[model samples]
Target: MDDGDVLTSAGVAAGLDLALHVIRRDHGSEVANAAARRCVMPPWREGGQAQYIDRPLPDEAGGGTAATREYMLANLDAPLDLAALAEHAKMSIRTFTRRFREETGQSPAKWLTGQRVRHARHLLETTDLGVEEVARRAGFGTAVSLRQRLHAAVGVAPLAYRRTFRAADHVRAAAAEEKA
Candidate 1:
């Protein structure tokens, strides 16, 4: 589950993801990617969102909203409505929405918002960016929106979340130094 120092998972796939998350936490993404390749697993599956998905990640080459999702992820700050997403996917709005829900088990808006929240959390953990900037980048438009969404997702505001991550990082660093 990854509540700070304690990490647990519900299944074998989740266990693999937990292990990969620990590798990424300690050794970084490249190391985690290499380890995933050695094990014949997808290089990365976001730990937070995967847990709630009813199905597996879509096969991008086999056709689905995968390309559109990639586009959405890259342009989180852009105004991405159903029209934009449908256009990107080369499908009608109804088809795109249906396919997106089928693939991801959530509506396009919900999935996008979740991705933005996840991005904001990552930024909070890894950067010193101000909340407003993080909000803008995460497509929340304002600090208040970021605060609301982050609170809804993680039950904490942005600054508090950052502080928690920072404190954890400090603890990890201290333990590493002690070991050395």
Candidate 2:
């Protein structure tokens, strides 16, 4: 079978290990191993390496962009305009917009929407909040807007995604309790 034709397991962590293996193969064992260590993940295994993992963000940046990113994450539920973000970063709007895209490969608006969606996902997974409350807390302004954004990002409505992840989380928690 071709490389593209190959198939493997079906779990998130397994896919992480598989990707790590490819990284190790292409970039050298030391670099990949170092990355796993930094993430506090276990070493990769060959057998369980065919799952779907979420893609991670890019590496760190040296500029003030990191501070801006931290601020964005911290204020995910707050109303953030370009001017506000620029002022926070102590840069002019034009310069901040340019530098933010250069550093993150996404416009400020797009990045903020992405962060809000992620925050909503976490709330959906971990909390018993209603969809409208999650929408409000995640700064999407309205449930309709939150539905649109979440549907665009994950190809599923917020409730559906929440049901799936919530069930999985419950199962995992039950298994962990049993093990204990």
Give the candidate number with the greatest TM-score. Answer: 2
The alpha-carbon deviation from the true structure for residue 85 of candidate 1, after best TM-score superposition, in angstroms, is 0.8
Clashing pairs in 1: 1-8
**Per-residue lDDT of candidate 2, residues 15-133 (tens digit):** 67776777787799898999899878976664622222354554556756678888888888789999999999999999999988988888999988988888898888889999999
Clashes of each: 1, 0
What tens-digit string does per-residue lDDT give for candidate 1 at 71-147?
99899988899998899899999999999998888999999998899889889989999999999999999999999
* lDDT of candidate 2 at residue 51, scale 0 to 100: 24
- Model 1 has an lDDT value of 0.87
lDDT of 1 at 165: 77
Span of ten consecutive residues with least summed lDDT in model 2: 48-57
Model 2 earns a TM-score of 0.65
